[model samples]
Target: MPDQAPVRSSALPVSDWQQALDTVLQTPVKARPYSAQIMRQSPTAFLFLIDQSGSMDERTTYRGRVLSKAAAVAQIVNQTLLELALRCQKGDEVRHYYDIALIGYGGLNDEQAVSLWSGAAVGKFFLTPAELAGATLRVDEVTVERNIRGRAVTVTEKRPVWLNAVHNYRTPMKSAICLAESLVGQWLATQQGNDVYPPTVINITDGVATDATADELLACCDRLKALRSMDGNVLLMNIHVSDERGNSILFPARADDLGTDQYARLLYDMSSEMPTPYHADIASLFGLDQRTSYVGMCSNADMDALVKFMNIGTPTQHNHSFTANLSSEP
Candidate 1:
C-alpha cells in the first residue's frame, strides 16, 4: 500500500428504502437525457455475479416444499437482468444502453473453485440472461412454508422460474472473483483501446468468503471505478442475498420507500448511479422527483443481519476533491 491511503468514494448515506429509491430514481438524469450513454461512452454493461456454491443447495421450506437459496436468487437475478436487457436496433435480443454478463461462482464438483461464467455455462442451449429467462425450470413454483414457532405448513406458489443459474457449486466465492478479474481485464482492454466505458457491475452473493478473496473482489471492483471514457466511468455494485425469506426478510419491506433501516441506508451508500436511461426514468417509475433507492434480498433474519454488517456498493465519504485520489490507480 502506498503512503497515500485508500480511495474514499463520494456516495451519500441512506436513511431507508425510499431514500435509496429516491436517489436511484434521480441518479441518471438530473441535468438532461442520454444519462446512460452520457455515463458510458458506448453501451453500458451490467455483470451479475451470482453465488452458487454447494452451500446454496441447502433446502428450506418456503410455501410447503423445500427449495434451495441458490434457486430463489437465480430466479430473481435472471428475471431482473432479462428485463434490464432491452431491444436495440438489431431486432435481436440486444440491449440499447444495457449489456449483461451473468457470472456464476462457487458451483463446482472439482477441486478448484470460483466458477464465474455466464448463465449458459451450466448448459449450452442458451447463453444470456435474455435466453435464461426464456428457458423453463424443473419447478415452476415455490411452496411458501413458514414456521411461526415450530409448526410447519406447505403451500405452492409460482414465481417467474429460472434454469441453469446454479448447480453443483461450492463456496469459493473469492476464487470466482479471480476469474471475474481476468474476464473483466479482457473486457477493459477491448474497451480502453476503443475509448468506450461501460456502466456498472452487479454482484449477488449468498455467503461469506471461505476462499478469503475479498481483496481480489474489491480489486476487480476498484478497477471498474477507474474505467473512464468519453462518457464517464464504470461502476461496480454489490448485491448480497440471504436467499431465505420473502417480503419481510428484506429491509424496507415496502417497495415504496427506503427511510427505515440502517442497513438499507448503508446499501444506498454503496450503490452506484443508475444507468443513464434509468436515471430519470427510475425516479419517474418511483414517482420520486429526485432520489435513489436501495434494493436487495435476504433469506432470513440471520442473512439480513449479516448484510447489515457487511457493507456494499460505494461507501460514503467519497470525494473527487483530490485529483490523485479521483484518478484511477492501477
Candidate 2:
C-alpha cells in the first residue's frame, strides 16, 4: 500500500465521549454545564484547569534561592484569586458573579482536583467556599520550600492570595479538559435558567495528551455555543506551555490579544480589569489592562495567571475572550 498520513488519535477513548456528545446534541440539555443545575439567569461562571505535571517544577534560582515550577505556580494562583475577589464589581461577592473551580492535573489520577473553598474531592462540578480554604490553602506565604520538612510544600509565602481553588491531580492533561468541558457545559445550562452567559473555562498544560481527549473538547465547546448562539457568554481557551523562557508569549489580536497554546493564555485573559489598589499591583503585574474585560484561557503561568482566573467576574462590565500559551511572548 502507498504511504499514508498517520491517523490522529481520537482525543477521547473513542465512542464513549462521542456518545456523550451525541446525547448532548440531541437532547436540549439545560445550560448548566458548570453546576449540574439550571442557570438560565446568571452572567457566567469562571473555571481554571491547570497543569501540575512533573515538568511544572521548572527550576530557577534567585538570590541563592531555588524555585520549583509548582511553587511559581502557587504564587501566581494566590495573586489570581485575590485579584478576582477584589476586582469583582460592587456588591458582588464570591457567591454570585462567579462560581469558580480549579482543577489540577499532573501527579495523581482519579484523585484529580479538589475545591480549595469547599474542599470537595471532585469528579463532577466545582468546590464550595468552605471547601476552598482547606488545610492545603493559604493566601500568602513567606518562605519557599518544595520539601517542607521533607514534605512537598511549595508555597512558603504568598504575594498573591488563595481563593477556593482546585489543584491538578494525576498526570493526565486531557482528562482535565474533559472535566472542564463537562463542568462548563453544566454551568452554561444552569446560567441560562437564570438568564446568564454560561461560564468560561481555561486550561493550561506543559505536556501533550496523556490520555485520549480533545475531540470532545471541540464538541463540548460547540455544545456550549448551542446555549446562546451569538449573544452567549460561554468561552473556552486552552494554552500549551513549552519549557521556554520566563516571559509570556503573546497571541496578538487586532482588537484583542488571542493566542494558540490554549492553557496559559486563558489565565491571563480571564482576570478582572477593575481591582482595588490592594489588587491593582498584582493585576497590573499580569497583562490585564484597566480598560479590558477577559474570558479565560490556559497558561504557562506565573504570579499573573492565577490572579486573572479567580477574578473573572470581578469587574461589573463583562470581559471578552483571550489567549492561551506560556511565557510573556504572546
Candidate 3:
C-alpha cells in the first residue's frame, strides 16, 4: 500500500479540529497530579525561581559554617541539581527523564528575571540531565563533617558549581513568576497528550516582591498554577528564607496558623495545596499530623530547613523504579 500522509492540525477543518480539542478537554484527568511515573518518554520538569535581591546578601549559617544567604541558596540549589543528575545516570549514560530551569530575579541592576545557567547552558530555558551535567562552570572542594562508624570526622568532597551567589537590586518576584508561567506554558505545549507529571515551580526568596503588591503576586501565582499537562495542574511551592534565629513555619494547613504575619500568610495563600501523595513524606520528615492539609509554602526558613523543604518540593521518589527499568532495557 502507498504511504499515507500524517494528518496535521492546520490541514483539518475548523469544526473537526474544534471537536477534537473539545473531546480532549472533556476527557477525565486520571488520578491526582504528581502520581505519574517519570520515565524517559514521559518525563517531568522543575523550575527554580530564586530571589537575588539585596536582602539575600545577609549572613546565614549552614552546617555550622556562616555564609551569605545567596551563597547558601546557591549551595542548596547546586546540590539538588547534582542529586537529580546522578539519579538519571545508568552506568555510562544519563537518561533525559526531567527538564530543569533556573530563573534568578533581581540579580542585576536592571531588575530583570533571567536564566541562571552558566557556561555551555547559558541563555537556555530548559536542560536535560546530561546537558546540565556537562554545563558545570567549575568544581569546588567543600569540607564537611560526617559520622562514620559512630565517629564524626571532617571530610572534603568535590561539588559542581552551576550557579553563583548573586545579590543585587530589589526583588522582582512578579516578573519572575510571569516568566516562569510563559516558559511552563511553552513546555506543556510540547508535551501535548503525553501522560507526564505536572511541572513544579519552587520559588525561594528572602523578602517581598517589589514589583507587585501581595494581591498582584498571588494573581500571577494563580496563572502559573493554572498551566497543566495530562497529569495535572502545575505546582507552585514558595520558600521564604530568613537569617533570624527563631521558630520557622514549614508548612501551614490554614491561614490561622500563620497568625498576624501578613508576609507569611501571603506566601501561604500563594502556595499550592500539598498533594495527598506527599502528605506521608511531610509527616515523616517534619512530624506533622498527616490528617491536616498543608500548603507548599515555608516561612522564615533557615539554611537547614530550606534544604529539607527543597527536597520535598522536588519529586525524585521514582528513581529506584527508573533504575530498574533501565536495567531491564537491552
Using TM-score as the measure, the top candidate is: 3
- Candidate 2 residues lying further than 4 Å off, grouped into runs, are 1-43, 60-66, 87-95, 110-124, 128-171, 213-230, 242-249, 253-330
Q: lDDT (CA) for every model shown? A: 0.42, 0.44, 0.79
List candidate 1 segments past 4 Å from native.
1-41, 59-66, 84-86, 89-99, 109-169, 193-199, 213-217, 243-330
Model 3 TM-score, all chains together: 0.86
Model 1 clashes, total count: 48
lDDT, candidate 1, 1-330, per-residue tens: 011111111122323333433333333322332232212234444555666777777664433445776755665553454344332213554433434455565565322333233233332211333444444344365567877678887878655544354556455655544544444444444344232334445556555656554455455445545444334555555455554454333323233354564444443443344443333432332334554432333223333233331222211112211111112211
Residue 162, model 2, lDDT: 46
Model 2 residue 302 CA deviation in Å: 6.6
Q: Model 1 misses residue 52 by how many Å?
A: 0.8
Q: Root-mean-square deviation of each candidate, in angstroms? A: 14.8, 12.7, 7.6
Ranking by lDDT: 3, 2, 1
lDDT of 2 by residue, 20-73 (tens): 445434544344322322121233456776777666666633234567556655
Worst 10 residues of 1 by lDDT: 1-10
- Please state the error at residue 224 of candidate 1 in Å: 3.8
**lDDT for position 54 in model 2:** 64
